[model samples]
Target: MQILPELGAAVASRRKHLGLKQGEVAAMSGVSQEVLSRFERGKVAEFGSRKLLAILGVLGMEIQFVPFIPAGSLDDLRLERGGGS
Candidate 1:
């Protein structure tokens, strides 16, 4: 799942790339213009999946899931270094 900020930025960038305005997307997606604006700005605390899908549909974008790659910890900080003490 994408973070809200990233999603919002992507939507904004896509919309701009398509030469669409917030109001135009809002009308086409059936989402309020203010809500669309807030979402584009990543100012909304909560956004529903339906709304997100609708907006993305209008923008000709879709969400994708990818494997989460865990970060590696510092070997020196690990408890078991497997080295002669």
Candidate 2:
């Protein structure tokens, strides 16, 4: 739920691809076993970004952002002030 399922899947997939165990990943990432278990089960929202980053780092992953649209498009929009023109 809440976009966590994809994250969990990614973590799980990456972990398996790296041939790492849950406990091993937890130890390497400095996250708790319970938290890692939950995350692999698609409960990533329960964990914070810091913890997620730690886990992802151990999995050889890092967070990155990509813009979906041009920045100027947002600034061109105007909000209605009231009934007045």
* Each model's lDDT: 0.88, 0.81
Candidate 2's error at 53, in angstroms?
A: 0.9
The alpha-carbon deviation from the true structure for residue 55 of candidate 1, after best TM-score superposition, in angstroms, is: 0.6
* Sliding window of 10 residues with minimal summed lDDT for model 1: 76-85
Residues 1-85, candidate 1, lDDT per residue (tens digit)?
Answer: 4588789999999999999999999999999999999988989888999999999999889999888876656764363566523
Task: List runs of model 1 lying over 4 Å from the truth.
Answer: 72-77, 80-85
Q: Candidates' TM-scores? A: 0.82, 0.72
Q: Report the poorest 10 consecutive residues by lDDT, candidate 2.
A: 76-85
Residues 1-85 of candidate 2: C-alpha lDDT, one tens digit per residue: 2557778888899999999999999999898888898988985556688888899888999777876764443334433333332
Residue 57 in candidate 1 has what lDDT?
A: 94
